[model samples]
Target: MTSYDPQKIIDIHAHLHSDLPSDPALRVKALESLLVEQGLVDPAAIDAWIDLYAEEIGPKRGAHVVARAWTDPAFKAKLLADGTAAIREFDYQGHATGHLIAVENTDTVHNVVVCTLCSCYPFSLLGMSPGWYKAAEYRARVVREPRAVLKEFGVALGEEVEIRVWDSTSELRYLVVPQRPEGTDGLDAAALAALVTRNSMIGTDLLKARA
Candidate 1:
């Protein structure tokens, strides 16, 4: 228990290498070399893991949703009215199952998304929510008032553009479906799709067609 205790040295050594091996693949190799891979964790099992790791973690599959809306009007409407069902149509599922709403972003009325009921993100497909987006400040400001929040995010809207704030419920999570910007006339669907970011799809920003 004195200063000579080996535990203190061990702790210091641990902290020294804490930030090492950031790459998961390298970590796996280290684990294998240390002979701790057995009964430790199956590398293949980790590979088999789908997007499950991203739970309420990311943008809630917003990019895919926006791409669909820009290309298919019917699909967009279906998604806006009933996100769960529309997502199922695309063979995607996980979280926010029972109730969901996808707001349509238009030039006149820009939409930004947030979940005040707890970060009910759809990470099974979207990956992970940005730390700033899932923060308490963003949640509170986005709910109490959205236009101001957007301004803070550097998203300025003119007086003619109305800002709509959407609240996310436990049963129903919402994502922003921003409108497609002009000037991308010749670009194909694939190129257009590339322009759709998860944030834009979730109404956090607008998509500028491949220009």
Candidate 2:
């Protein structure tokens, strides 16, 4: 217990949604497989559950949570202070670790998330990342000098905004929930969600609700 390194664990997934098990068969099957995989169920239910999920629900189901943060500042603070709850505000909640801090990509700092060795992301908010973000070139250079890497990504910020690079260590994971652009005050939730792209949440792009 004394030498426990909590930052050693991280989950970088494409998406995480509760809508995965919509049908009765799919729900039962998914539940069964999850139970067994976690050592919570017996072997008898594994095969049948798999078959049922495949036939009933089809593919894996997951939801995105970044959109909600884009519309609400108080919610955004909640997200920075409590990531799991902030994600839950939209639906696809994630694992609650030691702590989570959300840095807004304003006209000052552009935030990006990466695991130098592996992929680490906030699946609940941004969905899956593109192959480019997970590439070796991105992982290494992005951390050492973020501004340079972002320039390669077609992001050339002026002196107004600072480019900040954060390393998502093993114990704690970070999510870059970009700030809503200056003039997007009137956009509704649904309209705002469309702008909260995976990259925007990762701070690779600006979150623009209006042109």
Candidate 3:
């Protein structure tokens, strides 16, 4: 048998590799498989941990913040003025949430969030970024045509309302505080939290009146 140089093989293969997996989820799954194969971690353990963060801990944390802001004027004022400190009030802190900025949506103005450079999101609060959120098209088009992108997501704004797009960076992360839905005045904080949606928090969707 003849010996082949590994570097030479890799070089040839590199040329053939034109593009990467466009779907971030696919790429993540592939990487996870590789790690599992290498015995660096167990797949079941990784899934359980992810589920805990995504389902149990993630959106619920942000929902609580929104609920409090909706019900408590003082906390809402503090949250808008200083998101990082206000969020810490709930004992939610992580490296991913370094500098948090809460943008409030009102009758006159609406806020949307995006990461143009990369998928830099407040994972601690929002959990995993949606696949569409990490798409190149979204990253590029949302900043340029926010209204159109929002419309596609079934969120249409009035002509009088101003749309402000916040680009998240490594230094700061933004969370959209969606306006409280009408007819929810009687709802308590826990009930209000239940009405909060992940997309509303991301500014891609609006909070509808829950029956």
Highest lDDT among the candidates is held by which one?
3
List runs of model 1 lying over 4 Å from the truth.
1-61
**Where does candidate 3 have its weakest 10-residue lDDT segment?**
13-22
Q: How many steric clashes does model 1 contain?
A: 7
Cα lDDT over the full model 1: 0.69
Off by over 4 Å in 3: 1-48
Give the TM-scores of the predictions, in the order they appear: 0.67, 0.63, 0.80
Per-residue lDDT, model 3, residue 29, is: 88
How does each model score on lDDT?
0.69, 0.63, 0.89
With a 3 Å backbone cut-off (N, CA, C), the pairs that clash in candidate 2 are 6-171, 7-170, 7-171, 8-171, 14-127, 14-128, 17-62, 17-63, 108-161, 108-162
For this target, which candidate reaches the highest TM-score against the unseen true structure?
A: 3
Pitting candidate 1 against candidate 3, the one with the higher lDDT is 3
lDDT of 1 by residue, 1-211 (tens): 4699789899988985796577889976887656544677665666555434544334434565567777887987788778888888766667555566777766698877677767766654466667877789988888676777777766778899887876666566666676677876666556666777776755666566553
Over the stretch 117-163, how does candidate 2's per-residue lDDT look in tens digits?
A: 78876543344557887899989888887888788767778877767
Q: Model 2: how far is 63 from its true place, Å?
A: 9.4
Give the range where candidate 2 is weakest over 10 consecutive residues by summed lDDT: 56-65
